[model samples]
Target: MITDRHYEIIVYGATPGGIGAAVAAARRGRRTLLLEPSPYIGGMMTSGLGRTDIDWLDASGAIYREFAHRVEAHYTAQYGTASPEAEACNRGMFFEPSVARAILEDMLAAESRLTLVRRSELLSAEAVDGRLTAIAIETEAGEGEWQGRSALSADVFIDGTYEGDLAAMAGVPYEVGRESRDEWNEEYAGVLYMNFGPSKEVLPGSTGEGDDRIQAYNYRLCLTDVPENRVAPGKPASYNREEYASLSVDAAEGRVRSIRDVLNILPVPGGKTDTNNHHYCMCSSDLPEENGTYLEGGREERQRVRDRHRHYYQGLLWFLQHDESLPEAFREDAQRWGYAADEFADTDNFPPQLYVREGRRILGEYRFTENDARLAPGLGRSPIHADSVAVGAYAIDSHATRKREAAGRNVALEGFLGLGWLTEVYQIPYGVMVPLGVDGLLVPVAVSATHMGLGTIRMEPCWMQLGYAAGVAADLAIAGGAAPRDIPIDNLQDELLAADQLIGFYRDIDASGLMGKAIQYFGAKGAFRSYEARPDEPLTVERASALLALARLLPGGSRFPALPAAGAVLPAGADMGPRLPREEPSPAAYWQRHPLLTQGLAGRWLQAAGRALSAGTAGAAGGSVSASAAARASSPAAAWLRTDSAAAAEGGPSASGGAGEAAPAVSVGEWCALLYGLLLEARRAGSSGSGGR
Candidate 1:
């Protein structure tokens, strides 16, 4: 290992996030140091956890997308485009573990400014006055001893390790395990899963209580059904038959239905499989009891714990495949699948990285809680963060931590945290990446979040997105000669967008689609600011009408108003808030009465309105317009009444309540269209209706 090298950005833990950060930083011309404790570079992705669980819609960053596309391209190049491997590649969600590793390495190799050091551990971190100065690293010498020691200084440090080792060593304040519900007002926080099964024994902390226990850890097994790539199961060095005593009994009594009942064997490209533990299965490698201590353990201690887990899981696999007491069919099926000989060639086809679901999470500037992960109370989506750095779309899914018996059935607590039934997309703010009161440090992995909150943002894609953001933030900080927290968020957002990092979900509307021009038009008129517009969510009648009123006020052919920042924050009760005119009480009732005011009628109404405005006609059918309507319309409100009469005369549905027609809901895209139509008519008439509603 080279000891004389100094880097502009020092990244620890070569996980997916670390790779992303190192690449991003190096691309920006900053000399970067990427250090991995293990010999492998790709952490989980290379370590048999290849069945990616990603929310493709929210994965908008360039780096992550590029990585995904490369994986797809890899499969397509190796296998025919019409092959099953190509199909999985076309989907771009899952791939073989080795393929992912190769893609990451290729990307890393392209960067001239990156230095990769493997099998090096973080021995100590020197921080002065809440600012990290230097980090001491110990490179592995011959045998298990680390005789080579070196220290490096960097302008910025990024902790991309799943375990948060660098951040913990830097003296960043962090937490382990769940927090009480009261702490963050999180519904899934603290002790959960108390009454899930037959166990009467309460966790030391009662239900909904806080503790240091973290989610379970496991090795993602890369197996293969094809005999060509299969390596038969072998007895681990530390395996003990007694360790799987309960499993043997359970199998004999027919408690275990099938090997799949407890194992998640998801297929990847090239006939490989990414296998994980199932909730009801007795084959889990999760060592929940040792997790708390492991989280705080040193390298040696952690290695021992990892070894024990390996023995426990391997022993269980051996029992399932060879034990005579188990059902014959189950054993046969288990024997059909074996380790993929082509993958993880260095580790005898076993994954090198362990799945550390949760570790020491920094209590950063903003602690993202479960409340933030859930849908906004009144809105059907999540809130927009003014300082968002990335977008995350996934459910808060946490695995069980401790297993116990309840009512003669096995139960697990703090294992599965289902924060919400629906998978909602949310913004990850920049504040959470900045540890509280820390300087020159950014934590993209194991960020400042509650255990439940981490569940949603813990996916590999999300981590890579955060890593990209960190790299940009570091670049900006260095250029401005300022600390991370001191950099203006607006400027940072500018840089993020330049790097193709998605910061917010809003304004992600298609720029080339039908709504593109309309969104640009209304966006200029400041009409969308009335509410946090989820351009993706279905538009309610209330929002549709409000958008119309705002559009009518803008003069036809007038320049679009200056657009606000995508996620700009405004004081509560600001005039710019969605000032949608309040409808008569029972807004739903009014819509029911005038079904034509809903979605399906928007096109017809626009046509009629255009004709009425063109002819300068008013007072058709002699119905008087309401005073409020007259005050708001630049042209006579009688024109609207005439348009309604014209529609009625044309054998179309009348605006004054159709003949019991159903009110069709409008989507945000549809609302944009209607708004566009209205703007066009006003422009043709050369009139502008100005002022707030």
Candidate 2:
């Protein structure tokens, strides 16, 4: 086995996020080493978890888009582009496991500086003076280049495992289970049960108290009903009828209707479904408390854990299909499913990886909570995250952590939270990935977040985006000979922007353009609040004044002049904000139903504002815009997802930083862009928001 070599970056795990980190670092001219414990590389993506867990593909940035494109292209090339097969691909969001693996393999092949070693598991790690120094891994016997015990040393390391194995081995402070509600002030913290439907309502017996119990784990099975290719599942090697007794009861009660109710059988291309455990079911594929043993267990014990789940699920399926105790109708429905003949061909058509929903979450520089994903009481969007490295849009979803002790009763299982209630597209800060005293390592998949916080951040696409940022950050850190937290934020941000990765979310401006850059910068500086359609409807005089004022980082805020008693829009001569007319060359605030402030006047004010703000200190990305991202500001979350979802865009109230601010001449988008461009222009012209002399 190749060993005893020093590397620039060593990333453990072959998950999509790991690939993102390794490739990003390699592309930036770092010698990167990628190690995978299993023979597989794509983690759940190529391990039967087929339906993509993301909402907005456009905002997912480059690496995710590339993977999506390749998956779609694979089928489109075989079937005509307009064919149903191609349509079913959903741009690779719906895909076959093997195809995903092949595509990812190809992605890695293109990077010459990258080296990937599979079947390699980390055994031990060494950290000195708070910096990770070396790690020992044992690659299983294989023909592939590296095998057996090997020691690797790297300047930077990333714990990309679904379980924070490397982080734990390196003495990173990690916690297993949910935190108390009061600890992080998370609403869904601790033991809870909820009924998920049109609305998620918490059930009785839900205590806000914390526990060590974590969300359940299950394998995402790829099953198909295709006649010619279907392989009927035989009984598991260690099938136990009593283990599946609860399933039969659930079926009798109609809670388990068909195989569909028992599993989240989402359709993928080629007539197969990326089948996963259904949380709402009282008894299904999920064996809640069993996963805790696996999380804290060693490799051999974990393998046993994997085996137990596979056997339990297979036994349940067998019982549902054959037991006379179940209704014949239910049996017939269950009989329609069989292992997809094409997938997991080697493992008897079963997925190899156990879906470890969550693992060890390290204590980070920042511990994001459920509130971070909620709207700020007064702002238009989630609280502004100036240090954001990526964005998470999924709701705070967690599966049951424990089965009901009394199976016959209708009591909902504890710890099943499918609630998307008031969930917002929130930004993930760089602090979360940087463990509090640990240097030279970044944790992406098993990130630093509250259990509820993981609800939003625990999706593959989000991890890849964060991993991509970590990879770039590693490059910059190495170049500057500094820790990840100490590196220049602007340089890291610039690289991410250049790579088309989003650090900030804006609805109206195309993120690839210069306007997007301005919007992000100003938005981070406390300018824009909501993610609603670009505040394109002419800048209200009130909003314009607030934008300039916010950029200046003034302490107090001004309320909008009260609206006319009975008009649809503000009156032309309405008061805007404090002492605007007293400023040098300040034009009389016009009272237009639209565009109260034109671009010409905005440019003049911005020049003076920039010189003033910059002269004191460059707007700090080190902290939140005005309210810290941690602040429990109960601001009204503006409808940021409106542009992404038609239903959202059509509803919700967004206070555009001021009470009286609404439509009025330059678009807020245009103004931000114009203002930023002028700032850059002024910086270049050797000058700066004079209210136009």
Candidate 3:
């Protein structure tokens, strides 16, 4: 009783990445179909994860930024202000899961070219001539088949599933687990068994215990704090707290203090907070172990694992909320948050899907590695020819693969470490999205890459950007009659650059001008008026509204539309860009007046600043080394100079000028010379290349 549907492009998975891919493909004028196993979309954002782990917010593409802007818009419309925390108890850029779902649905509804199918699961794929030709799917209503599902048949197939299920089903080779140190010559690879400092001897994989292995997995409960809007935590049918007894015991033993220990709390509008459990300890919910077996697991097994996580998290919540052993303060806080009354009315307020942190990483023509994470010399020279999609800047963060004792204590070494370079972001090569041996397959979520590289690239914003890029690539392939991997890099870059995506560190006037315009647009839309934007700046709640009004998220005409009339003191000309000294124009103004000129100036300033900081830090470290070397004519001074010189060569400011002061205007040719110089240096340093092959 089911019918088959055909489309120019089909995107698997309805997660954020999937949504982005679908939108991109559709925007590109391609007939795109999005298939989701669940009835709702927005994956984690609409599921239980009201919180978002976004790195390099500045580097995110237009699509992702617009999504965030929409979230802001929704809250503003609902509350007459964007402060979700003040109106709700959760407090922190978090929202009810239902809100996210509605927004996503609306987004798709507005798009005529995109068709969404829910409760549909991909069963198998048909291949011809080593290319995927069709995909067979089973739905609740019946069964259907899709032709051109492969690299050759369909111009491109984007695997946007959280688990990379489609990519694995396609028989693409991938990897899971920490590679040994020898594998990539990385300093922090394989099972680290050493403890650097004070720690606890909980279990090896126990969250926050500093175990030398990855942490276990658990659910991120989206609870409410408002009594009127809160729903009590419900026990899953297969609940088993005993399975987590060891962790509970660890809590009692002072090994694990609170379940919120590792929670990455993101503040949404109002008082609601979105809690994400992706780090070590606490609800260490990223299952590196289970990820490897995902490809082999049957539907039942997958559900079982999902059920176990739900039970575990529910029990943990129950324990914290009512357990007599819990501290009074902890219990009080735990009781304040429960499921929102108006959100996720089904499944007892739990997210329908688990957040899949890692999946089947395709071993394509190139592989991104720790070296890339380090931004090693010459890493980006023979860049993947695909259009540079998005940019990422988080440090390589991987959880422990297995529990192990280090220095007589159980500790999890898997955690975040900042990449030393500042204002330096990594470009996601187009090739990373193309699957090798799969002619039409394009992977945005679990693209071909190394585990280390994924640590930074796995963030939500980055994934969204990647999804956007992949969608564009797919459309190009479909229109040009070429494999995704075969698309010329120049063409891709041109298109991507036009789309305002940040590719490499080097920026041209055009790209910079576009970004400036975007910043202005966002400001006008009132998207940048969050209290977090200037956390260090002192401002009262009333002032906060004033600042937000500048971003146009607030009612520009009314003074504090949501606030009391007495408190709503509308500033004169509040609609104008942020107030600045007469001598110093706003960033928006600077960019607007001389789009390219401003971009060149800013780029030069940033590069100069980077060089200055590097020189200073290296100089300090070299002083001590210099003394020792002086004794033997091997002054660390020389080493320091070399390091500083190398950093300077890599786009750091020249030795002569301060980073803040604007340099004299240079001709376009001169600017290109400077950029070319840096590009060449990057190549010589081996920092530029198409990722691993």
Identify the leading candidate in terms of lDDT. 2
lDDT of prediction 3: 0.55
Give the alpha carbon lDDT tens digit for every residue of 1-693 in model 1: 435556789999889889888988999999898988888887888888786766563345657878887887777777867888888654566888878888899999999989888888898998998898789998886424334788788999999999889888888999887788788787657666533333323343445778777888888998888998799989777777766667666677776767776577888888888899775554365656666667788877888778877777788788778878777888898898899998878877778777888888998988887777677777655665667777787777777776544522444444554544545667788888899867999999979999878988898888988998888889878887988887756456545654666665544665333354355345434444322445556665456556766655554423222211111112234455343435323545655544333333443344334544443456522322221133224322223323343342333332333442453444676566545544544433445344221
Clashes per candidate, residues 3 or more apart or on different chains: 14, 19, 66
Name model 2 segments beyond 4 Å from true: 1-3, 143-145, 407-411, 533-535, 539-666, 674-693
State which candidate has the highest TM-score.
2
Model 1: lDDT to the true structure: 0.69
Predictions in order: lDDT: 0.69, 0.73, 0.55
Worst 10 residues of 3 by lDDT: 551-560
Q: Over the stretch 1-693, how does candidate 3's per-residue lDDT look in tens digits?
A: 233545788898988888888998898889888888777787777776665655434545556667766776776666666353334412223455666678778888888899787777888776567676667776655323322232212546788886777877777777755566566665555544323223322224222222223323445556556688778776556655554445555566676666565344555544455666534452344433443444457888878778766766676667666766656776677677777666666776677777666666777776776665564344322122223456666766555454322432444443422333321355577777777776778888887666667767877667877888888878877776887877645445435545766555332222344333222222222323221222122223334334324322211111112322121112244353453445555544543433222222323222332332233455544442332222113211122122232232332222222352242232332222222223223323333333211
Estimate the Cα RMSD of every predicted model relative to the unseen true structure: 11.6, 10.2, 18.7
> What is the full ranking by lDDT, best candidate first?
2, 1, 3
**Residue-level error in angstroms, candidate 2, position 261:** 2.2
